[model samples]
Structures are given as structure tokens and as C-alpha cells.
Target: MIQNIINQNAYTALDQEEYQRRYDSLVERFDTTKADLELTTEQIKDKITRHRNLEIFLGELKNQGNLITKFDPLLWNSLVDYATVFEKQKVEINFNSGITIAVK
Candidate 1:
């Protein structure tokens, strides 16, 4: 009876240790994942800001009539290239207020 009690206690202790180890590992992974998510969020925000600035620059260039007939083709090509690259790496942000912004 005492031996049975000893065996049960040992088994319980081993099980508890294993559970603690697994729990610790899970918590560490969660922390790492949270950090990665935060970094990604910041990067997306930066991309949106860059896109907004580019739009403003494009508008200014247009207003200044920098795209004459001779320069139109080159300007169009450059715009197309920019659009393609932006589309390829586009980020979509959906806010809690049900607003969606596409940054490309």
C-alpha cells in the first residue's frame, strides 16, 4: 500500500513537471509571435504612408505640367512600373470601424 502510494506520487510529480515545461514553451512562442505581429503592423503602416506621399508627389507633378507630350510616354511607363510594384506588394488594412484601406 505504501509502495503504491509512492508510485502514484512519483507519477503525479513527473506529469506535473511535463505540463509545466509545455506551458512555458507555449508562453515563449506566444510572446515571439506577438512581437512578429507588431513588427508587421508597423511595416504595413509605413507602406501606407509611403503610398500617400507618392500620390501627393504625383499630383504635384501633374499640376506643374511636368508631363509634356514628349515626356508623357516616359512618365506613363514610370507610373505603370510603380503601380505594378505597388500592386504586387499591396497591404490591405481593415480598421475596427469597418473601414478598409488598400495601400499600394
Candidate 2:
């Protein structure tokens, strides 16, 4: 939509009202697209940050020991800051380093 506007040659105004109407419509479309792009960019950045944090958390967990073993309080303390046990036997663990993992 905005591409078609860009392709058009500079406006030579035959009537003042018509020229103003076209110019305003173009500006409105550009503003809407710009706002949408900003929002999408922010969402992408948030996902990238979460992914990086998850990678770091996994690295720390791997360095600790085998995950399948019996629960070790010391290892849990080293990695997790705190945890919340919710209804339905769900648990949300907040790691001291950076990420949160929910389990059931």
C-alpha cells in the first residue's frame, strides 16, 4: 500500500482540497505501518532475550549433574532462588541465575 504511494511522482496540485486529502491519507497509512513495525520489533527482541537466558540456564543445569537422579537440595539451592507450588501439583521454579521453568 505504501509502496504505491512511493512510486507515484510528486503531486502537482490541480485542486487544493484533493491534494490535501491524498497527502493526509498517505501520512496516516505510513504512521500506522511505522507503529506496527515498532511493536513487532519489540516482540522479536523480547523473544531473543528469553531464548538467550534459557540457553544460559540450561548450561548451568547441565554443569550441575544428571537431571534424572533423585532430587538434590544442594543442587536445587545452587541453581534455584525460590519456587512456588501451585494447585494441581504444578510448580514454578525461579532460578537464581536468570530463567523460570514451570513443571507438573
Candidate 3:
């Protein structure tokens, strides 16, 4: 029964290897997703700060009675376009196992 025992041990070792591989892959994916989320959060915070600064500028211009003239419509339109693009952006990752994950 030593041969049978050897075969069983080999099977167990292969199974353990497979499990480790899957676990490692999952950990890698989790780390990547976490990093992506952190980057996204930073981007959002930056956008908020930019919007706040814009508001402050507008308020100052209003105090000077130059709100309309000092604000270039073209520039404002471009900023709006950029914000729209950012808001509409979607990040999708597809795995070999036919699994798809999206972050927006």
C-alpha cells in the first residue's frame, strides 16, 4: 500500500498547490482593486478642491461686480466638458475566468 500512499500524497500536494495559486491570484486582484479605489478617491478629492476654488473665484469676482465679464464662457464650457468626461468614465477589468468587474 506504499504506492497507494505515495499517489495520495501526490494528489494532496497538487491540490494544495492549486489552492495556493488561486489564493495568490485573489490577493493580487484585491490589492490592485484597492489601489485603484484609492487613486479614484484622490481624484475625486482633487476635483472637489478645484470646484471649491472656482466657487471662491466666482464669489470674489461678484464682489468686484465683474462676475460675468471676468469669467470666460469658453473656459467655463471647457471645464464643464472635462468634468462631464470624468463623471462618465468607467473602469472595467475582465478576468480569464469570465468574470468582469467595473469601477465607476
lDDT (Cα, tens digit) per residue for candidate 3, span 1-104: 33444466567665767665666676787789999999999999977877776676556556665436566654444234222123477766543223456668
Top TM-score model: 2
What shift in Å separates residue 17 of candidate 1 from its native position after superposition?
1.1
Model 3, global lDDT: 0.60
Give the residue spans of candidate 1 off by over 4 A: 1-14, 66-104
- Name the better of 1 and 2 by TM-score: 2
- Model 1 TM-score relative to the real fold: 0.50
Superposed model 3: Cα runs more than 4 Å off: 1-14, 66-104
The best candidate in terms of lDDT: 2
Residue 29 accuracy (lDDT) in model 3: 78
lDDT of 1 by residue, 9-63 (tens): 5677657676656666767877899999999999999888667656765775677
RMSD of each: 12.4, 6.2, 14.8
Instruction: Between candidates 2 and 3, name the one with more favorable TM-score.
Output: 2
Query: lDDT score, residue 54, model 1?
Result: 66
Encode model 2's per-residue lDDT on 5-94: one tens digit a residue: 444525532565665577689889889999999999999997897777667667767886765467866556666778999999999999
lDDT of 1: 0.61
- Candidate 1 vs candidate 2: which has greater lDDT? 2
